[model samples]
Target chain A: MSSKKLFLIGLLVSFLVAGFFSFYSSSQPDGLQKATAEQGLDLTVVDSANADSSLANYGVAGIENERLSGFLGGAIGVAVVGIAGTGIYFWVRTPKSGETK
Target chain B: MHMPDGLINAQVSIGAAVIAAGAITVGLKKSKGTLDSQTAPLAGLVAVFIFAFQMMNFPVAAGTSGHLMGGALASILVGPYVAILVMTVVVSLQALVFADGGLSALGLNLLNMGIVSIVVSTILFAGLMKLLPKTRISIIGVSATVAFISVLASAGAFVFEYSLGGNATYNIASVLISVMSVHVLIGIGEAIITGLTIGAILATRADLVYGARKFLPAHNLLIKESVVA
Candidate 1:
């Protein structure tokens, strides 16, 4: 298969997982948080400064529907990261030997 | 795991930020001549995939959840230097836009997940590739094993940081055991995902895989065999 096709497949899978399948993800705390809680260290844990942000906790602030909020938040992340990553890579890559910019 | 605010004291966090910044600078220099049109897209795709998958946390060991750090996966797909840049982009965006990780602890998060994981996994992957046969299955297996170790290494890095300047007082022994044990379970999940994803890409576009490059050309294999015989 072509690189384009492969890239598209990857993008599609990312969307399927982040936007749709993320709803089924475990709601429990992650490994670090769990371990910290088990050791009674949760009391000292400070909240993120951006905890009040609209996109905090992987959900949009205004969106009441959990599914829509998550999907929108994740989609926005994918778009931003994708564009930023692509732009950075393209700019950072050096030209081929003897090839002009 | 993404480190939130106040996980470690501000002193350790600032120190880690400096180290992380230095590594990223070196990575950018190393990756400049390595990436081209054919590989740049794959590198970007890796960042996007890691960002998306990180949002989908799978349950590990009862109530604890774990997600893909993508260190081993990215390192194997694109070389280590590029992988660092890729992970940095993903982690940075997660903290800045989604606010998933704490802003103050961004350096800590980047150090463990991006620098440490990729560096350790790359070293392991390179060693395993030399030891094992240059085959797709072997590549997949090595990826899985390295992925598992990468998670543990990330966890170890956290413990080290905490030891230096942890805010709360606790038994270091207990913290070590609990953190390492939970990460062991999460490592299994990471291995499976990393293995299967690499397998899929190897089956389709083996040429695009950086780790598999030395294994792809039949002439290279024949030459090595002839030398051995």
Candidate 2:
């Protein structure tokens, strides 16, 4: 497949998957958190100084809808990672001025 | 595992970041020296495939879900040097773009998942392949087993890191056991997916597979013999 076609397909698939993940992600504790909770150590864990940041909780400020917050978070994630990743690949993979292709 | 911001201490995070940066620098130089025009595009495609597979999270015990790390898959399909570079790209993207992992903790995440898993898994897998028969099935089995073990090792690295910088006072043993056990099961799932994917690719385009070199001679011999007949 052409690079453009491949990229578009990847982007589309990423959007759908990210949407699904954002929608269906478990509210329950993950492994570390779960283990901490079970061991009664969760109480001692302190949030980072930046915990007050809007993105800290994967939600935008004043977003009352939890589902929307998650969707937005997931969408932003896809865009950010996808663009950044592609850019890095291009930058690193690009041949130098003197280098032959 | 994308450890969000504030999960690990800043010192640990920064330390890991330095290490991750070093690895990437080395990887970039190594890849530039060795990466052919042919292999570069394939590496990109493999990254996209990994990104796709990562989206498919299988059910872990109870309600938790786990996704493929693709460290072993990348390392096996590509060389270790390039594999680490590919994985670093994936992880860096995940952290910076999606905020899946914390920005500050990007270094640590790369160390844990990208470097440790890809580097260690590739080395172990290559070692095993030397001892085992170079058959397709054997390669798949070795890949799966190494992938599984590498995941467990990753979990151990997490536990060790946490012990040093952990905010919680949970028993180290319990945490280790829980994380290790869950990851082992998760690793099995990772193994199966990676094996099947690799097998499928090999069946179609064996030359595209970087790790299928040993089998290539035999396959070529068979093809030549058939053509002669």
Candidate 3:
């Protein structure tokens, strides 16, 4: 396959893999959080300013579906990151006419 | 760390978001005046490699697994700006499509992992490289050691952020000590992987490797002399 095709495929595969892992992630806190809890630091954590934001808790209020909420959250994250990251990269790496190979 | 939404205070989240945005803007500008055909695709490939490696989580303890944070690796392999871009892509994908991190916590995640690790680590690596001999082995060693320090730096950044926005009433010292302790071990893993990967790339295709550039001319010249001999 062409390099372009390979790059595209790799990007898509990363999205799919990330989506799968996000969906199946453990509900328990991650290592650091778990350590914090054990060390008596969990209580010091505070709520974010946008505590009431729709995506704040990874759910749409009244959605009442954990699986659905997770799916939506995952999809939104992928889109935002992918779009933002690609946009930044393209903008940064755009070649001038005189610089093109 | 891929902070979930609701983990940090809103103010901290917003603040981190602003910082992340500013850094990304600066990175874009820096790349614009300098990025060439050679560097761009390498950046993208570095992103993919990071994503794949992140999937292979090592057991952290009895029941938990931790993965590589490619900030140091990316920065050492590519430049810091491109490394940040690579990490931003990875984190953003994890947050949005995989739900690995919280959507609302995107800024915090980017700041802790992407900006702190890549930018800080690159600075440390570059500074150390300046002092070390410009050999492939020295580059690998410095990259590995700095990768460890960068991970520790990120852990420190996380602790500071948590102190500011954490909901708990726990002692800051305790939090710092605990997080840093575990991260030290994690950093060793990061260093080994980073060292090996960079070494492999340098051995095969130094031209394609960003951080290995310092060794390229000398190594290439040595190769040519050997061929002539």
Candidate 4:
């Protein structure tokens, strides 16, 4: 298949996974959090600097609907990373000189 | 794992930041090869996919959960250098925009989840691909195994970093043992997700997979040999 179709499929997968399947994700704390608790190192963890952001913890702050909040947050993440990553890569990318348009 | 602020002392955090900065600078140069017009969108989509997948946590052991670190998959799909850049973007976005990881601990987060994992998987995948038989099944097996071990390697790096400068005191050996135990389970999940992703990509567009590029020709050679025999 063409690279274009593959790219679109991958991006669509990202949106679906982030927007929908993410709601079913396990809410239990991740490995570091679990290990921190077990090792008593949880005390050292300070609140993230951006913790007050409306999208902190993947939930839109003050948004009553949990799934919608997570979906929006995840979608926003996809857009942010997609734009930032593509722009940086395309900027730094050396153009293959005069091969094609 | 996303290290939180104050979880690591300033000594290690800043030290890691310096290393990460140097690595990312070098990565920017090397990533040029991996990001021509054809693959540029692929790289971006991979980052978006990682960000999306990182949210889906799977139960590992007891109450602990693990999410897709994406280093193994990224480095295999893109080269390690570009994978580092992709991971840097992902982690930075998560910390800055989402507040998933603490700002102060960004360096360590980037190091463990991005650099170390990529390095380990690159080496392991390169080595295993050379040693294993040339077939799609064997290639996928090696990918899964290396992906699993890279998780442990990255986790071990965290344990080492913590021993050097963690604020809370604990027995180093004990810490290592417990961390490894839980993470091994997580590593299994990582392996499965990585293998499945790669398998799908291979079935659809093996040409786009950097790590499997070497193996594809090898597989063709094996088929040729069997046909001759």
Better of 1 and 4 by DockQ: 1
| TM-score of each model, paired residue for residue | 0.94, 0.77, 0.75, 0.93
**Candidate 2 per-residue C-alpha lDDT over B109-214 given as tens digits, one digit per residue, 9 for 90 to 100:** 8998889998788789878988988888888888889888878877788888888887655678887887787787779888898888778666665555678765
1 versus 3: better TM-score goes to: 1
Per-residue lDDT over A1-101 for candidate 3, one digit per residue giving the tens place of the 0 to 100 score: 34365446546655654445555544444467667667765454544445566764444445677767755654555455555555545655656674633
Q: Which of the two candidates, 1 or 3, achieves a greater DockQ against the reference? A: 1
Of the candidates shown, which would achieve the greatest DockQ relative to the real structure? 1
Of the two candidates 2 and 3, the one with more favorable lDDT, higher being better, is 3
- After superposing candidate 4, which stretches have Cα over 4 Å from the reference? A92-101, B218-229
Q: Please say which candidate is ahead in DockQ: 1 or 2.
A: 1
Residue B211, model 3, lDDT: 78
TM-score of 3: 0.75
Model 3, span B181-201: residue lDDT tens:
777877888888889878866
TM-score of chain B of each: 0.94, 0.91, 0.91, 0.92
**Candidate models: Cα lDDT each:** 0.88, 0.69, 0.70, 0.85
lDDT of 3: 0.70
lDDT, model 2, position B208:
52
Positional deviation of B109 in candidate 4, in angstroms? 0.6
The all-Cα superposition gives candidate 1 an RMSD in Å to the true structure of: 3.3
Question: What is the fraction of true interface contacts found in candidate 3?
Answer: 0.23
Ranking of all candidate structures by their lDDT, best first = 1, 4, 3, 2
